[model samples]
Target: MIPSLDWLLEQADRKLKKEMDPDVIAITRAVITELAAEGLPVGVAQAFRTKQEQDALYAIGRTRPGKIVTYAKGGASNHNFGVAVDVFVYADGGKRAEFLAPPDPRLKQIVAAMKRYHMQWGGDWGSFPDYPHFQLYDAVNGQPKPLLGPRYPGRPLFAGAERMDRTLIRLIQKRLRLPLTGQFDWKLTQFIEQFQRQHRLAADGVVGPVTWRHLFGFQR
Candidate 1:
């Protein structure tokens, strides 16, 4: 049988409860409780990270030391926003809990449990397979949008020139050196398409994740 949440936390060294978003912390607690009920007592390995810490982690195996553990740098990761968490399944009376890759049974169970809480599993990512990671997601267009706050929509800002009259239009105009008309008309769409082509992104004229990342000087 599994132990109580307090007991489980006592068995671990890190209590990242204070470092996570309130909703994310609640969801994580629920997941942990449910996992324990099912005889799979998992331990929290990581939670929030400051931008400086994230930058340090990003430097691993590239500049500083250690192996490559993460792809995001500084402000690019959900961990920096207290929306992501990593977990590990403990064994031998909570004495040992190692990070396991895919094809591991415990990882599979954790993934399923996280999904029940409407969380996105990092193991499901196509480019980076992180079996021990999970985060809050807002469903949009059949895709899981990470909770990136209001300032960062975490999804498409504007697509297909639909919202043609907004402040973003003025920003785009200023960015492209066009007349500051504050209109997302066909001219702006054509300019964005050209920019997308130059940047090797899909020329859909929609300010999606890739486009926004590039426009805001984020690493792809």
Candidate 2:
């Protein structure tokens, strides 16, 4: 017997609410709803993970006894930033969780649902395909990218500054989907202003701690 849609959705919601970013939560919920409507026993296997949890998973193949499960270490995975999730299908009368690979018709359906939300699927990865993984995509490349925590400097970053932290500038540029030039240029400032307006922050074209938090999807 297949799992009831309510049971699957309840499980998914519980996991997703643990630490998932709002955008990730929304997309994952939509995917689960769509697949479950089709009679697929879709469920979330993993959601946002702390750095310690990520490190433990990383050690599974290297130091622990298990097959290699992931390539990212602590702070390197999208999961560490609440942007990624691993989903599974219920089988054996909803008692067994199954990860589907390519050529599986149900896997195809799940992937389609994810794509509807502009999600990036690990199954589509060229190397080390992870059939159970999906993530929010970067706007610039439409690919999964790790979201680092806010690495704020002491002062605000603004255009026309004599000197700036190139690394932080690049990170902001990446988040804003601008050219990753690592320079505080006028164009980048404009984009920052736009983002601030969209998020209801001050449209001052300055990147401060608050702006940084918003840019990286952190709770204020």
Candidate 3:
């Protein structure tokens, strides 16, 4: 029941074919396979849910899915671009459920397993709450960041939409605070809006609920 080796290859962005040495891919696959060894590795699910998934699941403003999952749709989501993935839970009786819709207890098990594999849990992605997603991260010392350097030195994002200059934005935010807004000499509204786009925040400049909360806890 292990995932097909080819499926893992699709999970990576095309640029990965250029950047990732064969050894790197093998190492990553080994990691994921090893984590699922205890359970039946039932093959890889769609790495990232797209706008189509949202459309299918939502009849009204409310999500038809059992759990609150995913905030990003299409280009906005890390998944649509292939940076994240969802895993299913397998127990006895040969039952497997979508990780995104799995019960809470199962979600915890997946998270623990993901942590063991050194993947970042999407549940860590702020209050929006995503229990079944994981993304890879690389870091040295105590700082965690995208494995590829700025502009993805070797690996690049899939197709369109700028990769979002995370390092620069993070640097500016860290070096400067609310006062940094003054550095731009732009209206507060515009500043917040830009910040949001750069950091993958919802682009609403009001900073009403989620935006302000992330800013507060965000380091510097």
My TM-score estimates for the predictions, one after another, are: 0.58, 0.62, 0.40
Q: Write the per-residue lDDT of candidate 3 for residues 76-121, one digit (tens) a residue.
A: 5544444455555434433454554435664665666555435677
Better of 1 and 2 by TM-score: 2
**Worst ten in a row by lDDT for model 1:** 138-147
Best prediction by lDDT: 2
lDDT of 1 at 96: 78
The lowest-lDDT stretch of 10 consecutive residues in candidate 3 is: 150-159
Residue 60, model 3, lDDT: 39
User: Stretches of candidate 1 above 4 Å error?
Assistant: 1-4, 10-14, 138-220
Encode model 2's per-residue lDDT on 72-184: one tens digit a residue. 88888888878888998998978889888879999999988776555789888889888888888632234554454564676889988757889889988988888899989
Q: After superposition, which runs of candidate 2 have C-alpha atoms over 4 Å from their true positions?
A: 138-220
Candidate 2 vs candidate 3: which has greater TM-score? 2
Model 2 clash pairs? none
| Candidate 2 structure, TM-score to reference | 0.62
* Model 2: worst 10 consecutive residues (lDDT sum): 138-147
- Colliding residue pairs in candidate 3: none
